[model samples]
Target: MIGRWHGLVIDCPDPQALAGFYEKLLGMIRVQDEPGWVVIGDAPDRPGVALARVEAWQPPKWPDESSNMHFDVRVDDRETAGEKVLELGARRLEGGGETFDVYADPAGHPFCLVAW
Candidate 1:
């Protein structure tokens, strides 16, 4: 491969808060914390998630075709994971089945908790 995968970076109003949510959700450790950026992962050298602060950020609307992408997270128990995500400030979204459920993060990025 030309280059290895680094991480998925999300833009939000608060990098720290978003990073904290994902850190707990993904069980990843903080790798870098800066003024407008925060990175979390299994290790410093491994691929993970990054959050970047954006000025006047507008969240993507659910059920809209304008959305570009979303994340799918696999879990052992969908009920437990769904409850945990809601407790962590995620809002449930439409369009999911027995194997998966959709949610929007604090920053309004769409993601799914899947069990399959």
Candidate 2:
């Protein structure tokens, strides 16, 4: 490969705040923080989640073919994890199966909570 995969960048209104959500959800640390850019992870070399500020950003129409990207995080219990995710500012969304549930972050970016 030419270059390594550094991180996944998410566009939102508040970069730091959105990054904070991923930090709390993934139990990661904020390695870099600035006005419109933030990266969450203890190790820069490893995969991280980055948030970039966007003006008047509109969230994607989830479950639609137009929706390009999303995250799938693992959890042991679907029921318990679903409850916790709601507390973490994730809202329930449509289109998921038995082993996985779809949720939207505070910025309305879609992600999946998978049972493992």
Candidate 3:
């Protein structure tokens, strides 16, 4: 590879809040915190998730053909993970089955909790 992967950056109206949600969901610590940017990861040197503040940001609508991407998180127990995410401001979406469940984060970004 020509370069190393840094992290996945998500755009939202509030970087702090969105980063906090992912930090708890992924059991990561905050690596960098700033006015418009926040990052969380296992450690400072490792690849992590970054949240960038975007003004006039519009959330993607679920089931819309124009929506491009989402995150799939692997977990040990779907039921437990589902409950936890719901408690953390995530709302369940329409599509899902025995092995996975879809949810929209507080900012309306879709992600999945898949059982391993």
Q: Which residue pairs of candidate 1 clash? A: none
How many clashes would you count in candidate 3? 0
**What number of backbone clashes does candidate 2 have, counting pairs of residues 3 or more apart or in separate chains?**
0
Model 2, position 18, has a per-residue lDDT of 85
Error of 3 at 77 (Å): 1.7
Q: Once superposed on the true structure, which residue ranges of model 3 sit more than 4 Å away at CA?
A: none
Model 1 agreement with the true structure over 1-116: per-residue lDDT tens digits: 89999998888999999998998888889999999999999999988888999998998777874468778899999999999999999999998998999999998999999999
lDDT of 2 by residue, 1-116 (tens): 79988888899999988887888788899988899999998787778888999999999877674448888989888888889889988999998898899999999998899995
Cα lDDT tens digits, model 3, 2-81, are 99999989999999999889988989999999999999999999999999999988987777744577889999999999
lDDT rank order: 3, 1, 2
Once fitted onto the true fold, the runs of candidate 1 whose alpha carbons sit more than 4 angstroms away are none
Q: What ordering of candidates by TM-score runs from best to worst?
A: 1, 3, 2
TM-score of candidate 3 relative to the true fold: 0.93
lDDT of 2: 0.87
TM-score of model number 1? 0.94
